[model samples]
Target: MKHLTEEDLVLLYYSEPEAPAHGQLHLRDCPECRGAAESLALTLNVCSEWVVPEPDAELGRSVWAQIAPQLEVQGGSHAKRHWARHLWGRPRPWLWVAPALLALLLGTFYLGRVSKRVESPVMAGLSNAARQRILAISLADHLDRAEMLLTEISNAGDSGAADISSARYRAQDMVDEGRLMRQSLAEQGDTATLALVDEVERFLLEMANSPDNANAAEVQSIRQRIDSGSLLFKVRIIESNLRTEGQKS
Candidate 1:
């Protein structure tokens, strides 16, 4: 009464040619394996619907090409499959892919940043003024997005769990994107700009960590923080300054 492993179920789910030969036959007759497969399928469908920031096409393709072979070269397929099935085949098999996907995303993002630094020749001819203007424009866009996140949270009056879930996801992305911008501003010795970005980042992080079904009190607390700091006003001031700087050249 051996059951199919998570790897086997995943392979069969995707109809990979190398999947275990009897995997389908076993699932047809075994309720346990079939249930596992269904859970895995549901998780996969949810993952497919995630709205992630689109990376540049060429950069994504090049990075994928360079790292794709490493995925296959890790261990002998038979040995890896055996280990995956034996030790990792307990409950919630879909959870196993979470860490792997997170690592892959982080690795890809790190490499993409490094690649831009390596390809600095693309911006080598730009004058200092031109670079400053470009930075200003980029900062402006970042502030605009951050402002929108704040507005959403402010206006989410009596929203249900679903609205909270959507806002949390968007807040998470805003927090991630703000990290790089904050670092850039700090390095440029723009303390005023850095402070505003830092403030917005903190607010975004709070929203990201809020309970999925945040209660009225929790939502109002966040709004109060926004009002107390005049955060939206400060953001608008910075956005206006950046726009003026961007228009200078």
Candidate 2:
């Protein structure tokens, strides 16, 4: 018969070292493999020299006795099973309800902020209308002053008349005032008023830049433009609106 190998003997020693028949008979008859298997067993035995110490007999019995009473007091094994069943029964409903309530509150807060931003423009327009009325009234007053200065300049006989210099200076001053009021009206968000202001500003700039000895022709041309542009009519409309708003307020 074929002799057993060292590997077969080693496996046999660990698995069934106390076997009285089959494998033991083979190892006894197989002298060469038996020597190799015996060497390997000796090495394993030397490496396992670190032994785990057992607790003292009294200490082991005390620990077991203490744990046994506590376990019994807690209803023993039934407590763990009851806890596991409770958790398994209703956990998913609580998990969904918490997140759903949080999402609803967040959505309500977000919509409230969005609604406020949407209404801001309407509120701003109402305030802008009030400011526009005030600016319109101021512009009308400035225009009246400008018209008086222009009339004085038309009546002057020559550029060197005593009052001519003063009249020219006053006329230029009035032009500057008109330009400032026009700029103020533009900022008030009244586009119709701003447009009329712009036209008046351009006319004033032209007249203010003319020579001290401005001709009748130039003066008449400016007057014609002033009449045809309906600037006076626009001013009157603005004044009327101001009065109406003031009455309401």
| Most accurate candidate by lDDT | 1
Q: List the residue pairs that clash in candidate 2.
A: none
When summed lDDT is taken over every stretch of 10 residues in candidate 2, the lowest stretch is 72-81
Question: What lDDT score is found at residue 79 in candidate 1?
Answer: 17
lDDT of 2 by residue, 1-249 (tens): 676666666667678654334777766777776787788888888878978798787997897885664342221111123332463453332322222322232333345467855343322344544544444444544444444444544445443322333445544555555555554555446677667667666765676666666566655665566677765556566656654654454
Candidate whose TM-score is highest: 1
Q: lDDT for each of the candidates?
A: 0.70, 0.52
Model 1: colliding residue pairs: none
Error of 2 at 70 (Å): 98
Give residue 204's lDDT in candidate 2 (0 to 100): 57
Task: Output the TM-score of candidate 2.
Answer: 0.37
Measured against the true structure, the TM-scores of the candidates, in listed sequence, are 0.53, 0.37
Mark the 10 consecutive residues where model 1 has the least summed lDDT: 73-82
